[model samples]
Target: MLLRSTKAVFTACTLVAATAFAFAPRTAEACGGCFAPPDPPTVVSGHRMVMSVSQTQTVLWDQIQYAGDPEEFAWVLPVKPGARIEAGTSAFFEVLEAQSAVRIAPAIVDCGGGSSSGCSASFAASDEFGDGSAAPGENGGDPVEVLHQGTVGPYETVTLSTEEPGALNDWLESHGYNVDDSSQPIIDQYVAEGFDFIALRLQPGQGVKQMTPVRVVMEGGSVTLPLRMVGIGTGAQTPIVLYVIGEGRYTTQNFPEALIAGNLLSWDFATSESNYVELRDQALTEDDGRSWITAYAAQNFFNTSVFDANFNSTTLIQFYLNQALANGELSSSCALGLGYFSGTVENPCPPGEPWDSPACGSVEPGALDSRQLGCVGAEDIAVALDGLNVENVWVTRLEANLPRAALSDDLTLEAAAEQVPVNNILTAQIAINPEEACGNGVIPRTIDVSNVPGNRVAALMTTALASIAAALLLRRARARLARR
Candidate 1:
């Protein structure tokens, strides 16, 4: 009974992660559950390093940097074929430079074929916190090498030929591994006998075209849009500002929502480093209660992106911000400082236990009395989406036309989705309750995942600290007994 109670507590505490996602954690079976793959591979490629450890995750609707709607807290990685990984082990990925990257992560199931603990994130980002891009196994600071991903699947190698020399050779050299055929970097695998890597069919290199006009189409209760560049820019013009003025229903707003969400994250607008505007409700019961995030037009090469207060029949994205500008939604930016999110912008260290006991937004770095604007136009879309009421209106896709708002003289969105391998690129799934906006107290659902690094790291730290404190208290109790 004690063990059962403890397990229940641990599981309950584990769901606070904002990174829960839709795509399963690339496993034949869901984490904590059993599954079987069809015609499994016989001689898989990678299956060397496998460890099994349980971890916990925190959940939230990350506004600026995480993902479009919110991010699901789960572990993800692209493996080279022939990897010998298992549960309880960590896998590492190489990262470039010390920069940040924003993404709306997709929840991918492993070779074992299992769903992730949570739904997919509409928006997921690394840079919003202002540190830098965190490789797969990073807790804080430098990324630790993850040799084995916790995902459950047969290890295999990619079986494709390419004219472009892969960075495999250089990667091997850096990792102190040989570049022989038997030593080729493993990418990913599904069937045991076959090998596969996330190959780029339409390579997004040579830079994504600019001012590329883009659009998306919608249907009854479903919207499917393919995103890609329309044209490449040779010359420069004053960066154009595209204000998106709509009601507080933004998440289910479709591709336009994804596009704006991406731009907001990439531009460093979500960080606490800038003067931030806010709107939030103390009551969790309020729908589209009040929250709209926006910023003034930057006189830089980049364009201005803002969310306005308006409503519409169907939420469609835009390539223009003229309507928003006409409505005069520009706020004052005269003396704004880098507004903080997650309360403390630079969390010298990850906040654990009792820290957020009162709540994350309970404390403040800037206006102590303020909260940043999110879902400003989030509710309107939520209502419309809920009205559609498909078994799953909780779905969205990636944007085609990559955005462009030149950087401030020294600022750059170094974090580009293309920078990550095509396989690493994914979209988050959002499931909002028109009935329960953000307050699903008992967010009762089964959590299914195997290898969540973020959770492992947090759990290790939390449990370790707790263990130490308990030990100290026990020592004191023994001393008292001896004295008696």
Candidate 2:
């Protein structure tokens, strides 16, 4: 039940889509807290945030900027014990988004027996780090315990723990972080729950422009996200995209899941894309301003080639095992052996040796090496994890739009194993039209109408007939009276 959480920040809003698709499956839980008032505010417009959570790990990526001074850019994150921090490449996210992005294809509606008016169709398509060093700090007897201090990419990182909340704020302020009164309450909450803090700041002479994507790996039972901390800066609402890759789909444990009305899907005639903007917006709105929407879910088999150019059985086993370790599905010790067998083996890969090395190869003679037993040169790790069945591997994506009020709460994921099927891939994309228009070229026309002029003619004829009848009745009455 060890849970890990990752936080990422980026520079522009355009990267939201790409960052959203970069996720791994793991279990997650929620923690309560608020962020200190940033001097210039951390949250801003045109910023994108993405998070991924499974049973054992959680990953978060977001965009950040230095609003005040280059030296003022800093971030504080809450994490469980055994957290590992490192820089990540942007290519990983870009590739995932491209592979998993929702593809919008124009649909053709033929109005049979039509002259020129019938159908409409269209088509469409589409981090930071800092040096490796830590400032000298006092140790021992301090309310806060500094576990690790080092440079990751362009940011200086410090992992610390303390039972006293006030000491945490002081430690952060002493370490050159902008910790205001607002941060204390949040710090207290985490402290009460025995959570550790990871404080990050730009290295000397390093600006936010030099910031890169950072990954945080922690050990815990459930995924925990400190969204309230994200609200410390200025902003009306923040858009959050999360992808959960696991055995099955995941849903929100704390918030309601946004219900998507796929039935309302319509084609946008102007843009040649599905007019899903309304539907997406409506789903986000109906959730009462804060909710998680399961946008996409399915099992995906990734080709081992994606990880290694010279793919082989040894490489394939190593790749899947490494992913499993990163996601907390497999332990480091087990990963070294591809987590295939639990018993002792002779001539195992030496400590620090590559997993694909012959030393790590199976000792069974004439039998296909571990790589052969595990199919190599395949698109996915199915052969390596044949025991789990490749068909059952799946990834789920969730999305949310949060206002400042909603940021006070934490986000957690809950999923059941039975919800997923083996050997199936389910992918979904929200179809929002850049231009709102229903694509069908046909405009509705009124077929039945009664004109005012026609009504006037009928009224005149009825009046004339009534006048003639009245005159005849008067004549008949007068003639009868004379005869009498």
Candidate 3:
């Protein structure tokens, strides 16, 4: 059957990390539409979700690996109105993870020795929605309506809404999606709430390896995640990690905040991240079930040079011009040139080089370099970056260990009144001491510290005191002998 491509309405899922299924038959009824096929075998792993929000704009990136047949791989997500879906760079996630990852310091040990006069310590620390206009009554006679059809990366996406749950199921089944009766109740719930569903399928001939990160940009709202939908195809326990970027930190509105005890944190070895995962898991488990734990949060300013490659001189010029207009510095019809300076007749471009010159295309395609030809100057880039309002920003990372049972209801997030800045990168760690009685039982490698500053200072001071006392004793003896 030919699939109808058009436009409709619904709510969107927050950062539900990608949950995998084996396409098994359901023994019991589930809450939402099941995307898994019937009676399949073998459960798989690996699900991760990342989200970044700023003001009214939210960017959600989901990473899921399909171990099943490439043709059978499909993803269905619920989104709110005016969400624009796009393909995101995997590097962005990598950068964010590395920058925001928790780090642990090296364990310090005091060897068995006499009192030292001196001691030294050292420490080290480290998308817009598409603008396509939609007309009413685009789909013929079906309660399910297609709102928008677009391709993001390797997947073909269709945004849909339907008043009738049965029609929605039929529409999905006809389009080669596996929607069973178990998903009916969930569909009914979303339909009743007037939520829109986005169905994504790998394009024909595309393998799972071709799948890249998918980004969904939704309009402003308290960031909400559709837990019910996520729990549909997963096991009893699923792990979710989310990164939220905004003006401040965020917390779960429904669940209690899980706190990791700093006292329990310790450095295992200098190079290794110790017991962090274990501690994190323990914290999640201790917080009852389905609790949100703040992992990392920080406020940072990014250099404009980071995004230099994404914009060209033409775009930059236009961007500044728009800013000038918005700030009432220029009229709407004001003409701007590359060399245009405030009341200056001289052009800023070097010799024959004009601002509009082809040499000034954009930043070079590699690492950020202000000296690269075609790159916007540092000052101009800074101004442009300011327009984006990203200079001063907060990044909050939250994680949850959720059982399928806890995901029965949708999750809503509430921003924290005060955001704590993650001034240092935290590493997973367990405390270790050279003489500690209980630990991993593995003795840490010892280093010779006899020549260390504290040891040397102590030895020198002891020798000096001994010499002074000897001199005093000798002087007294000499005086007594002389008197005799």
Candidate 4:
């Protein structure tokens, strides 16, 4: 599908040494439609980033969302020198979201007296996450040394380093960079702290305007995120979503960690909305709005069905064959045959290879080109899987709403004390009564409060709801028997 573009500024910050951050224009929606309550100066709503850390190596993928003149789009990230930038695909985020998004099962309903059997409904898992936009401001500098300059996908990239204060800005301006005036201090701070900067913009004449995601591979496994630079062009209550792939579940080290009280979660039958968001807000508010929630955590939990469908060895071979056909390198589709004493071995199967293997399958007039297998999106899948070390890796999803003032310090990440997994599918314990939903019954009832463990009121409410539901079911069963 084509991404709809608009006219607005993109702003954001990211780090290889310390995690990363991103910002969208005030008019644009923040990362994945996840945002904190609206407040003035909250120009940047939220952003999504993926970080994979194994041993001493780290790989980060940041999706650069931009809505404005393509020429005006620029992005800058801080790294610990020697970081390499590469192209990343949106499929990585899309697949991850589909697998770990918070899902709610429909409430079980019961009618006191009715011809219909008490309702028990279920729904397919679905979510409406959004994307955030961000681009860097420009300027120039004298002592700024351009370390490495090259192209990655459709972006023109340059890595710069400087010890002199304000020299980075001068060099950026001289090179036609459009960094914001307010960002000079942040840039200088990184320089003082010994961090190299990688800047990017659209390659002239690339034709594509919308910016895609980029990957940064660097040494060191520090999980600190540079939030100070995030405040440069963001508003209060900035939302941040991070997906961490590591050896174990990672949580906030310097900041407080918050988890949504599952027992407090309820479904509002009237509005068809869950109290998940409200509970999330309350949890953060209780922590003074400077905490990260371990939204979802698990190990060996990726759903590779999408990747498998589009990028297996069979699909790769088919894609290569299709490309060969289009190039007229192959006359027609080919198949491998094995029999006792074949008349002539004309482009026969490779010797000793299994007949079912792709290696043995050759196309008419020529062999399938191995280089063209990348056209099937196999490379992107490989990048995500390999970079993340998907085998036996622990994946953690973290979220937070940081007020502008709270962005004073960078966020540090560390493995959680307990290595337990947190499920994203939240089943509401409280159920809104249908009568109450229609203004007839009393307050909504808590059907199953077992999640709360020690509440007497919850136990009583659970017993009452259970009795009512049992009576309804008994009546329905009796009516069915009578009819029979």
Candidate 5:
């Protein structure tokens, strides 16, 4: 009786422990040693460099390995002992990686007397693939009966032809398929335009302009096919514009005086990254001795990224963007990345006059509003390139105007004083004050008379508009006077 009682208690205890564990929360898995980023960034030997490059030592794997992450990745200097390190602020080269796997889902199916394997395909194992503009070769592979190679359009549904159409479920179960469920993930992929690799081909140093898109074939199941493409040089300031637009990285960034005078060098996205995917896919094509990837995803990634490179190091650091834009590029592009004249009184002011004047001058504490007057930090971004001939640059100005002045006035005042439609009133600003305003309901304006030197200037007052016009006499005189 004692032994049976002990056994029953042990069984109950085991069940209780299992039940408790089943409901316990799981911990987030720590990601380590899973990915190695793209190229070990280094200063290219032959590239031009204008900024005084710096590097800091970061020991990894117990001093067995050491690397330097630059404040910015451009023409960067490698890490050497006793070398100055670049200060890191934002981002660095990161590698996108994934573990390839096969998955299937199970369901009820009536496989009606079909051949083994349930499904069939016209199979072709070829040395050639990724025919961007090329047709499939007639002699590539032996045709096999295949179930699916295309989308299930309405007209092509299996409902009309097959009596036992649930063979997809049967095939999936037999193959132990695990479909990546959740329609949201697939839809999100399309909306985000996210890809493991973006294939692009471009001329050397062309950058974003040449970044063409390459697509992957996603059937019912996950298939990581090899992709390859080429991109062209966009030469835009932010090469990664389209990829990061909704994320608020959109801006006109400028890099002024980043190059040295005399050498004319241009920047380009390096291609070493794509070489990886090309080798991994080991893809073949219809073309004899051709690999499947013209450029593989692993290989194509290299073309999608931006690298600050020197086209000509000795050229004047002050190079202009190919086409001048109305506004400047990124703020840091001029002040930080290129290392222009910053850290002045315009930046974060350190307890001084002018910049640190009155608190009521701005809406935010310790920040300058656009309306305030002082040595502006933004002025530094306006690079006055000496050699460029920028003709007829329109400088925009904003001004506030209210015709009646008083909200109580029942006045229908329409004012557009800037551009004169009539020949006489180009600069004429019509100010209509109610009869009661000149004295009764008027508030006196506090005009600073400090520049008038003790307010000694004499005032010659004209009471009537017709009298003022008569003093000018001719229409041309009135028109000329209207200018002032």
Candidate 6:
């Protein structure tokens, strides 16, 4: 049993999170869970979540970030009844985030009359919460009902339900959870909406240093994130990064959708700043701080280089071998190519023996037994691939910085009207010439605002004026030559 009590308010830290999804149903297995927080009072440093959706079920993997005393940590989620809890690993998010993050291609610079290395440069950047369980109060007079209690991964988890206004908080307090009075209204709101609350705490002797991630599985339930709960104990601007995998591209239905206008951005050779942030902030600001940018959207979106490199046969076998060695089940003399899928192998076993043999080579890579790779939590990869049908499914990544005011309403998602895909690699359209880099860098030679919406007329007018100015300079030169 675990228990703690402190005055600190409960904070559910999710990056661009708190929503529900529906997708194909599958057995809950291990996956990437919450992120590891380095310090207490975990601030709004953005969040990441993955949702696989289908008609009948939705599996969401969220990272929980909490920096505080291990025993004092408490995470509460307003999930639909019957939702199942499961353990997740950090590698799942690590791989997906690396594969999907935005990358900026280096600027194509033409340094006439000289060669300078600083002209062209490329840029790229890769950039959750709770579970716990406790002994249920035995007093028959308690109003809160303990629906389910069990251990999932490193945390002990418990699901509770009650209709009374303050019964749930009272129960949480009795269990040694430091529930603050400010959260009562939101807790009441969720309770009034017929939502069940789940509280997770680290199991006995478990500490915050270990990043334990968890997921909530909902069946046949169409739900949106509870943004109200996410706003508690957060700063004014909370960045939410959401990834949705489904049959087709998805977009936020309630909040306005914005796209980073790549054409308007430029790479500054002098400063090495891509100016991408300026355009992104400008677009979001135009939407009153309640917009989500569709950073990447496409079908069959996995990066073969990143995914295959991590999930290939060689790495899986190595991981299995490491596990075997640590468990003292196999001798260090065992070679890499040979592995036993199940049953303990004796140290210095006879080679090529019928009863004691290495069988890893005979099994196909895709068909390799997942049980053998349990030490690395590779099952979460299979769960994602199978549940989302990765090869044929659409993956969408949305980003937003929601001011506290915008978090009042839950965000809803729907299939995008246009299924066109957006590329994550942004190539700079504007080029720079190092010879004149300090003074706008030959922008007139390449800058074309003609294709830009609502700017065609201005582009043409500017072109005409430049042509007229050139002709005037030519006439003056001719007059001076005649006088000489």
lDDT of each: 0.19, 0.43, 0.47, 0.51, 0.15, 0.51
Best by TM-score: 6
lDDT of 5 at 42: 20
TM-score of 1: 0.16
- Residue-wise C-alpha lDDT for candidate 5, range 1-484, written one tens digit per residue: 0000011000000000000111011110110001111243322111000000001101100000113331211100111112111111101100000000000111111223221111121111111110111122321331211222211111111100111233322322232322112222322222233221111112223322101111111111110110100011101110000110010111111110011110111111111011211221222211221211111011111112111222222101122210011012213332113312211111232221224445323233533231221112222112111111112111111101111111111111111122111111001011122111123344323222224432221111111211222222223323543475
In the range 259-322, model 1's lDDT, one tens digit per residue, is: 1232121111122111111110112112221111111111110111222223221111110111
lDDT of 3 by residue, 190-293 (tens): 77877777777777777554246666666543466666765655667655666665445667776777776644555534333345555556777765566767
Model 6, CA-based lDDT: 0.51
Error of 1 at 236 (Å): 36
Model 4 worst lDDT run, 10 consecutive residues:
1-10
TM-score of 2: 0.59
lDDT measured at residue 172 in model 4 versus the true structure, 0 to 100: 71
> Against the hidden reference, what TM-scores do the models get?
0.16, 0.59, 0.61, 0.65, 0.13, 0.66
In the range 248-355, model 4's lDDT, one tens digit per residue, is: 788877789877787766665655556676677677765678877887787754322221222222222233233233323234643222111111112223432323
Clash counts for the predictions, in order: 109, 46, 21, 25, 58, 30
Distance from true location, Cα of 453 in model 2, Å:
52
lDDT of 2 at 214: 59
Model 2 whole-model lDDT (C-alpha atoms): 0.43
lDDT for each residue of candidate 2 in 1-484, tens digit (9 for 90 to 100)? 2122223211111111101111111111112222323444443223323444433334455443223344356666676666666554332333233233333333223333222111333323210010032334656567778888888667777888788858888877776665556657756776776667777767777654424555554432344455655454424555565544444456776788776564455444444545444555567765567876665555533332222222223232344343333323333323333434322112233432334666664544422233432221211222112222233444555656666678777666666434642211111122334222323443332111133433332233332332332233334433544575
- Model 3 TM-score on a 0 to 1 scale: 0.61
